[model samples]
Target: MSKIALFGPTALELFGHTVHAPLQRRAITSERAAEFTPSKRVLDHVHSTFPFLSRPAHITVFDRKHRRQKYARCHLGTPALLNFDFLHVGDGILAPPPEVALVQAMRGRSVIQAAAQGSALCASYSLHADSPTIIQREPIATRASLEMVTRSCSSIPGCKTVRNALPWILPHAASPREIALGLVLFLPVRLGGYGLPRPTLNFPIPTGKHPGNLADRRYYVADLCWPHAHLIVEYDSDAFHLTSDQHYHDIVKRTTLESMGYHVITVSRRQLNDPSEMDKVAACIAKALQKEWRFRVRDFPTRQTQLWTILGLAPNR
Candidate 1:
């Protein structure tokens, strides 16, 4: 087995197994990296073999000896070098386990982006694939697994980032857009969300008793649900949701939930794109939950803007 484990964004790209976005890695992945630590000559030999490791983006690796190089950003000490875990994806190329890879991936990511990634790790689908449709797989890791690793590395800087990230994590989130909605709505008010209580993503409510459920759909899965409040917020993504048949399906689902005495709220991509519109939607939901939705912070606007930047929801200047 190769000891040249990929770390950082290079790992993330190969699934540091994170997201669906295009990854133009500036870092390197060397098969010869297995023999990287013996000497300068060995390292040079290893590095030279991978002519394709020419990307300009930084990729992290374990290099305590601190050998100088163009692309590798070495993690000299702490967890990445000593305590983290790894697994083989294929071809004898070892990769840091999901929990470890996620910890490494968070180094350069904004808070919301990292939270989404962490949550995605707990999900049951693969974001990295050649097909447009996300494929189903056993969850690569769990919130508990991440927590275990984070606690083990508490003294490390990345651990604190992971700690800060815990509050916003929605372990059951199903899509990137769903993650965006959860962060914007449930993240603390200081972090640019409305400060709503965290909701369970894709919570299943049994409809087995309702005879009117003639469609034989046995469960109504809420995109974001506050079970205690019986409130659900559904994200109607712009993709595949604009069709007439999908619109009818949504109407039926909303009516079905309302009939069951649950308050249903819908958030569309357009509303999420426009902050003012989203605020109105938040207000409507808050009214349903009997919570006052108001901001008292003086720099709230600037902070929320930064949050937008973090979420990649802000428009380009």
Candidate 2:
């Protein structure tokens, strides 16, 4: 039988054990001197074996019935070490050595590291296959996984606004699958539909000559171009309008392009949801193209007065 040590009050009560006479005398003697004085070799062994327990506030030694006495602590003790392979810890399971009890004690509070939490712990156990496996397989309950899943979900555009409302909307969704379903159904309708054209979605608008300008910095390059009109169409989604910085930058770019005789049309998320909006936008583009083509054909002024404003130059005849 493995020798078990009972540390705290609860451990002693459960195991029906008491502190060893010699260890208790040592504790009393150390307390009288107002300092602990365990042998250097014992202290060194403890420091090497269980690093976290080295400077704990208080320590005790307890003997289990029919078992040798082992060390305990007022602050930290694992259920495995307390009752000699009998009492299970957080998940109410007994684990074995080299699977060392000290390791379990240190990580008892962390649900992710607990054996009962699932395959993650199982994988860790497999890696240390030579170590003794904990006998009891109780599941450790923790909110960490749920929090991580929620954080990832919130990073998406429409989902950002609906994160707080998720629990109320779907209380049963503790796992990612249920949360994903809820997000799919709730987000699109809640934040409004995806209005932009899927084909041109996220296409970049390239600034022709001065690519280094701030106005062109954030824009992406699209394959399609209306070179004659210098027009660029950007299909905007909620994601595009996420931050004030992005929104302001987009406005500046649009103004700069328009000033350079380029007609820039931004199809926002809301406008895209309307079926007739695309037709209206298309008509505007056609008119702009016709105007540019007509000017080229008639040999009229190719540059507009807006170019002077855009380039910060004085208008000349």
Candidate 3:
């Protein structure tokens, strides 16, 4: 059986399981510290194998039974590290897989917090992943691995939020802002989301520039596109888009796309500061959808949250 250890930021970083978005960690209070020491045998094994972790910070491991011991105190009910893909961190000693560590790292937190962390993990490899601090060196979780982790999260209680948020976490989101934009638009209004259909990310459209000339052919990659809705949304970063040359090019690109019958909407960081502003943003998209095609919004999937049921949350409640 895989050995379970004390889960914390140091262990996660050592295992390379950081996220692009920020989430809360369960603070280790003095009371929790008594149960937080690593087994001498496990400590020796880890030190012998991965000495770098020892230098940066002290390591901790606890008997798996300690998980049940703190059913009420730890609240997260022992870090969920079962059947995890152990990484061979040199020597024979193994570390928890990045995906598993992510789940464990957010243990004892609310569903939204956990899902936000998971969303950051899901978006890590997307074209727009974001982290204010150092760049992560470990590989992000793949779709398959993410799906596996989502399923496994059900084994823990109060994880419905994480499962519910999975469908909204797109792997193609170019950045955290873009993900925020899409979620703002696609998530149900009741959840403080726009309640619209999911939009495509980094959608590629042929620009028809030198089409036959393979070398000179060009394409306009829309940040968020809904082909059927004929709507495109872009989150503009001043640092990236304010240059004179870039501004001129953007005008030409938008003109070309508009001429092709695509309605483009550009949003800035300032605009997304609050719910009222985001509501106005969604209104703009809704108005465009109505004016362009006269198509009605599809019936919202009320049961879009069956995964919550899988996670032992009541569907009716």
**What overall lDDT, based on C-alpha atoms, would model 3 receive against the true structure?**
0.54
TM-score-based ranking = 1, 3, 2
Candidate 1, 29-128: lDDT as tens digits: 3433434343334334334543333243233345555445544555543433454434544333445666766777676566776687787777656653
Scored by TM-score, the top model is: 1
When sorted by lDDT, best at the front, the candidate numbers are 1, 3, 2
Can you write out model 3's per-residue Cα lDDT over 219-296, one digit (the tens) per residue? 888888999988999788563648887777777778778777789999877665444465568788888767331213
| Most lDDT-accurate candidate | 1
Off by over 4 Å in 2: 1-224, 239-241, 291-317
Cα TM-score per model? 0.80, 0.25, 0.61
Error of 2 at 310 (Å): 42
State each model's CA lDDT, in order: 0.66, 0.32, 0.54
lDDT of 1: 0.66
Q: lDDT (0-100) at residue 264 of candidate 1?
A: 89
Comparison by lDDT, 2 against 3, better one: 3
RMSD of each: 5.9, 24.4, 10.1
lDDT of 3 at 83: 43
Which residue pairs collide, candidate 3? Answer: 38-61, 128-174, 128-175
